[model samples]
Target: MVMTRAANIAFKPEHKITMLCLSSSGQFLSWADQSGSVSLASVGKNHTLDVKGNWHAPGTVVGLCLRGQRAYVLDDVEGLFCVNQQGEVDWHVPVAGGGFSLHEGPTDMAVVDALGRLLRVGYDGSPTDLTSQFEGILKAMYVSEFLVLSFEDGSVKALNGSQVVWNRPVRGEVGESITALGMDASGHLIIGREGYALVDGEEEALEMETWCLNGQGLLFRSDLKTRLTHITPGLGSVVCGFDNGSVTHYKDNQHQELLNTGFAVQSLMVRQNHVVVSSWFYLFGVEEGSEPWKIEHQGMPMLLESSNDGSICFFAGEDQNDWTEPEPIGFFSLKSEARDADPSELTEWFQRPDTEPERSAEEIYRVDETVENLLTEEERMLMEKPPVIGLDSLHAALDDFAFASPDDQAQGTLNVDAESLLDDLDDQLSSMAMMPDEGLFDALNEEVVAPIAPVPAAGEDQVVTCDEDGTAVVLLDGLGSEDPQNRIVMWSWVDSTGQEIATQARAKVRLSAGVHRFELRICDSEGQWSSDTIQLTLK
Candidate 1:
């Protein structure tokens, strides 16, 4: 069975851990607690406890970024500290400037402070400051060859590290904050704020893209404004986890809503084709190319880290000091296909179908009064289709191919099943040979045949049974009710004119001696009509 939820543990208060990180090689799973203590466990060997360190600080450990052998821990009071392989702090850089974001890359790690200063720290132990370029506090930053920063002033800037590349001033004047940011596969930077987008040449503001549960409009109204909580790129789309417990994906310049998490998504990591997100007590693993799946845990998990090698996932939360020790961390094997793969999967909420008509044969066309004039363009263009038997056509074509047409009579070569047609032909030739002087159909023209009505309805039997007095009578059953109150019947007279006659009430009419058409109409008490008509022949 797939392990969707982690087993529960008794609450403890002393060993309360909150954040976790894994080295890119997947050998170590490191965790930090609320008591300013950090622990490293060896997951490769039955999760053997390795070592831990306590960095006494006033505030909590907010985030963790791992590069190689060193880990950078961001705290609410201690700024950012770089710890090495020996579980010792290599250096502690005081971010007294107050930055809410800390990010690490392959070659360097950077932190953006409240003063809009993007301090790039490299392995050489020096800092490169990109401060004078922007006019607002940097709300979020994405680093590649180009560092994309979304500022509180509702603008986004593309910087080649510290130098400005291009900038788009957004229209969100209310200073809402840019909550999440990412670069799509197309390389156009995408910033998710309260409601709008900053892409290419256009900045689209929040325009009620969806309605909230309260029936109020949730507009993408702010430009690159509003604090972006988390962002990850998958396939051609960007998956963003917001402060509202809402996970949204942007594709083809359109926003698709995913899960509506009630709590803020604290950490989001994308591993080999999967997106793993953590909030308080919730962990969700969304297939990078597909949809999200939930993994159950009760106490709110704070930090989520997946194997950079795509082999495992780790979730850490504060373990209380109760008599029963709570599990401070949980492990998931990313490559364990048996556990990750399942046939039954829940669809993402943003993926529900919109209200639209179903596609089926019964709804292909609607017949109405202007059917002739309302022909589809393609049908109207086929006005020149020739009749099966055109003007002055001879009937002899039915038998003209006998000399050269091989008998495909079995497959209906001449409008008849081969066996039956051959049997009839044999009987005809045998009879002719046996009695040459006998005439075929000796009683031909002497038999009277009754006319058969091709189409029949409930009341059609009465119309054709009219007596010699030409009076037709019908019993009104269930008439004037809400159901079918009228029906139409048509009769064609053999020796009379071919005009069709329609009727709703029973009455006698002067007969014209030949075939006649009759129709019936029924209406309910409230004037609602039923739609059944029939055709018959009058002898």
Candidate 2:
């Protein structure tokens, strides 16, 4: 099955998770718990972040919303404080009455206290009383620049700048709380619950399991299945996640069942063809096709959130009564990462088919992370890009060998002593087969071009001394593998008398001696020569 289960992360045991929500920028999932502990996690990367600062509250965190890197939080004691990504509290506002929920807007948040005070808390660090227009708020929805507040008395008011612009009585009972409030693309408010309809006028009551506006008409669930724990509006569709272990997707009023995991489906989200859900102890998803997939997990699924366009998803699970940090889960794209990926990010994927093609650090369609190894960037370039041989990058063999430093060139003149060792090697090579070449050369510093080494005349042995051969033959592999720069422009042979014998690699010598000395030299393309001296003793 499809999975992005890269790794596991554990947290301190003191945290008791209460609520889960996405950051204002949708890049991270931030949640709070009973112990005043707040944590932010990167979704696609599967990591629980220990934000570099500390957040301390006198009581449990009641409600919070993350936008950008700042976390605007509310505590049980009617306290409102703003904490940034680094865990530093930017400001704190103490209210007279206890507050319950916090709804975030583009630039600020509207909070309702137990004393029925509808105050706007954000910006200047002080709560601005929004004229107490609604009380006992059942639910609040932020659309564009307007704050839509639904009160327990079944009164729905659309307020702009704390001033009521429109008021309407909802369809449910006076004390019934609104489960969902949403706005269509054209800015028309759609209220859902006992009976779903638009506030504009009379419309057919919707059979929506969960609803969302697709800019066209009411999009709702059709084939009702099991008990739903969560539902959300997706692009051009509505998605419902049921506790009956089923995820249903609806488009054009037709519903299709994607998959049924026998476990409790805690959360469900749909973005285009991508569907992400948390069920039982695992996070599962269906993207790009009808194939259902599962991700491995270490804890129970607790919270989930997704990008508006459905490119990636973030979910976390906490082990029952195990105070450690929750296992952060998310949907990874196969096309490219979210449009605003971090610079240091190494991978990108796409789930939405219609999404415009965007360049990524690495564009990988699918990665079988378990079995297939991840290729480095250089390896990928070598595998994907065309060969440099026939392309514009072609170069000569000599071009590859770089010029040595002046100091290195000066040190190149030093010679290696191969005296006795050369004699022993020559004796052995005298029994081996060899190849030959012929060339005429000037003395040591001859500007004339050099010929290749001479071929073995009749066999390996070349009698250097006419009366008695020093070894069997003179075999010169002097340059050997010592041509580090591949710049051995010429090789020279010298005798024990310090006179150049021949300007070739190997030659025969007539010597009358008890001991004799000889030298073999090599030159680089830079015209610098280095020599080795070998001594042979004849008894």
lDDT of each: 0.53, 0.56
Native-to-model Cα distance after best TM-score fit, residue 15 in candidate 1, in Å: 3.8
In candidate 2, stretches whose alpha carbon ends up further than 4 angstroms from where it belongs are 1-7, 10-14, 20-29, 39-50, 114-117, 126-129, 172-177, 183-190, 195-231, 242-246, 260-265, 306-313, 322-539
What tens-digit string does per-residue lDDT give for candidate 1 at 348-449? 211234558776665567545476687787886686575567423533543432323455434422443567668878999987785533455555546776
Range of the 10 consecutive residues with the lowest summed lDDT in candidate 1: 491-500
Taking the tens digit of each residue's C-alpha lDDT, what string does model 2 give over 1-539?
14343322323334545667775335666777656887655544444444445576766576777776667778757488887767778788885555566788766688866434577866557555565455556577687677878765456777777677666555532223344565533354555443433353544243333222223433344424344445556545456666578776645556577778888777766666676777876767776564565654556666766566544445555655332444334334423422322422212221112457775656555554742357787877777787657423432533433446566666534222357557767988986856442333325446765543322111222224424433333344453435433445456766543335444454444344456667776555554566776665544
Q: Per model, how many backbone clashes are there?
A: 51, 18
Shift in Å, residue 367, candidate 1: 98
TM-score of each: 0.49, 0.49
> Whole-model lDDT, candidate 1?
0.53
Alpha-carbon runs more than 4 Å astray in model 1 = 1-13, 52-63, 75-79, 96-99, 114-116, 129-138, 173-176, 195-229, 242-249, 254-266, 288-292, 318-327, 337-539
Cα-lDDT of candidate 2: 0.56
lDDT at 296, model 1: 56
